[model samples]
Target: MTEQLLPENVQTWAQAPLPTAPPEPTPAGRLTIASVPAGHPYVRGISGADDGVVRLRDPLPDPADPDRWWPPVVLDAAWITQNADVVDVVHVHFGAESLPPGRLAGALDALDAAGLPLVYTAHDLTNPQLADQAPHEADLDLLISRASAVITLTDGAADEIARRWDRTAVVIPHPAIVAEGATPPPGRATGAFTVGVHLRDIRPGIDAVGSVRTLLAGLTDLRAAGVAAAGRVVVNDRVRDSDALDAVAALLTDRPDCVLVRRPRVADPELEQEVADLDVALLPYRHGTHSGWVELCHDLGVPVVGPRVGYAHEQHPDEFTAFEPDDGVSLARAVLAALARGTRPGSGERAALVQRRALARVVQHRAIVRAHTDVYRTVVRRTGASA
Candidate 1:
């Protein structure tokens, strides 16, 4: 039999090369970056002190809500004009979904007037939070057309960007979410496999009801086959009042085999423990580009079953199993395939692997940070030379 070849994007991720040379300093002794939402884990993972780049703290639009950074203040033309002296370049990763095309264009015009180059990371080609795709596409059209450089996490996304806007984007792998040397929880007792489906607040991109039902169906089939299996559904307390939550509850009614967990949004440590306790994590995204959840599960050494919609599979091809979105049978097969790969490592092996992966992430993170620095320097230089 002929060996099946992996997709081009999968191969690209598998063979992605890392930069070893030390990064050069910025033309300015130290460059300050105005990351739209600097508090996000992905943004923090790709930034470091040694890269000659400092990301400014996210502006507080609402004083009462300190954690909120939506409708990023730096995207405002007025904010950019006032802070132009301190911020060398604007690197927008998220929060543009909250802005209309006209406002985002005005912000880009401001950056042009101030000679501040824009480096946009296409994190979400299709905004997962919104039901409609047109608004997000409009935002992408403006941002990509005006950006001095573009960055994306997966090669698949890069290809899409090139095809859509005729622009090339630098591909950088997502860094580990769990901190270095972070240990995964001990593996669960043998003979019982747990499948987890976290429908946190049922975002527009997530098929919460469908995912839960599919998990229930899959678990039922597994049990009928004499393979011990259980399903767990996790949802945020904030979604309790929503119709999606009601639908999910109705599905779980009288299902003695499935357990439903409800809680507020959790911090990293809590989340890590939660995911580490499961045998497999199910990603229920109906439509979106890429996922940090996949990265989180990888960091915890837990296998993930994700939809084939985006580059989630490409993110970690070995650890990820793909199923068609909203298809129960496909999900069942994917779950079975994932569990059949064998139990996650024992405690000692898990600890050692986590340490080794952590060390590797440190190195890869440096490369990611260096890549951002290089983009910043290149854009700044081009802007200065033209001036």
Candidate 2:
């Protein structure tokens, strides 16, 4: 049989069905699952899905506050306090931050009081900035110890938690949505044969600014090597004081040799489209365990460059070379080497390797959902669920 074709921009994957908790049997109770995401898009995305047990509203859309960590707790407490009987299980993915307001805590307490479970999936400090791991470990342990069951997206994350907390967590990697950047027309960049990229604000500290400065200096060297590059580095100055950004901006303001523009975060597709024009993507992060962005590039067959902090062992481990976070001299050589390599496909066959690998790396998330259903089954048996 011939293979059928689908639209390029279609989002083919979706959350799998919940088996443990069958659809509302008769007028029987519902599986009230309360969840909230770190970002507004995820919050709106998941909550709007008809599959959730207890749909939660999004919190304030501020992505810069260090204290705005427990967005789920805020969204959850609101639901449970007002309608405790409706929320059977509170499922949340967040880091170790203070719980929401007192009423919300009271609501969560009420759920526990009623024998409902609180399930938490840890995706916090995804790229931790703390100098010491002890505090981070403690915070994570505290949260997991309190949760009825814990879920994670990587074996790395599972190992990190089990080693410290003396408890195991189920591994479920994040899944992928469909990518439509198979073919782009005309010049790859603003100019012929040039590549463009954007590294949004690394964070709100001095070290992050220093990382940007080092990357800019490196891009300048790449331009000097004749690989014309035009891109921007978004800096969320609101995360810190204006003085911090002003100081960082000074370094780029004088550079006429390179086109180093600065801007804010944008929609996902806009960013992806920006990446599609480039032959390669540059991470240049000083710290982090893994990156979803790197996955984005590899999935689309767009080569990536950066320090070795992303999920290197799994995707393009040999394809990457590291550079000192704040050292301009070392970064300069690395950027030049990356720009010299070509990423254009020939006869629609070149990117096949990357396209296949990206799909394989992403399906792990679906496996995660299956594992979660198992946990739900165990919980159901213990709770005397008819299903």
Candidate 3:
């Protein structure tokens, strides 16, 4: 998609002059970071207790609803300017989607005025929540251009960043999602294959309805072939009453081969277990870059069937099977191919494997933390010396 021209006001702000005061010196000892929405699973996964980097507690946007952190306060230019003394650097991951181009430019301006180096992890080139890619590309154009350092999860993404923005991004592998020592639930029954598709709130990036239809079709074919197979379509309470839910329900009517399961949003552990139990986890995303869900499935040793949109297959090529987005036949074929590979190890062996994987991830997390720490220190040292 072509980059959208930023609004005139944002352009004007980008060229406008600001205060010329040097930022406060880096705090003694460990570096303090003001991460945008610091509580996200990805951020927590990469952080280590001994990494010598501390992420400030996320500011509550709503006092009554403490969990809501959208429109991250840290991204507010005023907040960055006021609290610039406490943080050595500002690292942004998600939550920029909450701000418009003008406001986001202002935040960059504030970082400049405060002399706080900005480290941005490019988690998504295209925001899945929006159908139009231009708005998100516009955001990327601004953030990537002004960021002091950039990071991405995969080589393909890093290359794309270079091609699109002429910026080099440090390629850091995504850290493990499931915490160590968390036991997954018992595996599903033998001789019966289960395919799962999670339509969490029906975001614009996900082809929820089409994905369900494709899985149902695939299940029908499997049953006809004398294979004992079932399909599970899961949706959260957020889309329980929406037209998307109604459409999905209509498609599943009288279709006993597939069942639609609805429930409230689940915590990370529970969600991990749910994914671990499936024979094949289907990612129904129509567009986006990278995937935490793919990583979750990989952590639990579940094979994934994902759309061929982003670098998800690159994350774990052996564990991922790609399909044409929104194509029922292609998705069905991919599901069959995934199942043909084989089911996960028996419960006893699988648990031991999971433990080993989790233990190894502890080491991986430390390395990821170290990589981030190095990036933070580089920017802070450069800025400090220049100041």
List lDDT for all candidates, in order: 0.77, 0.49, 0.77
Q: Residues 1-387, candidate 3, lDDT per residue (tens digit)?
A: 001111223332333333234335544687888788688777888888788877887775554546655566677787788778778888898877666457788889999999899999998998876777887888899889999999999999999999999999999999887665566554655557778888887777878877777777777766776778778888887752388788899999999878888997787666766777788899888788988888787777778897787788888888788877556667667777887664553566556666667788878888898999899999999788222
Residue 297 of model 3 has an lDDT of 78
TM-score of 3: 0.88
Off by over 4 Å in 1: 1-28, 187-191, 385-387
Which run of 10 residues does model 1 get worst, by summed lDDT?
A: 1-10
TM-score of each candidate? 0.88, 0.66, 0.88
Worst 10 residues of 2 by lDDT: 1-10
Candidate closer to the true structure by TM-score (higher is better), 2 or 3: 3
How would the candidate models be sorted by TM-score, starting from the highest?
Answer: 1, 3, 2
Cα error of candidate 1 at position 207, Å? 0.3
Q: Write the per-residue lDDT of candidate 1 for residues 90-138, one digit (tens) a residue.
A: 9998877665446688889999999899999998898777788987888
Q: Which residue pairs in candidate 3 have backbone atoms (N, alpha carbon, C) closer than 3 angstroms, thus clashing?
A: none
lDDT score for residue 2 of model 3: 8
lDDT of 1 at 286: 84
- What's model 1's lDDT at 380? 88
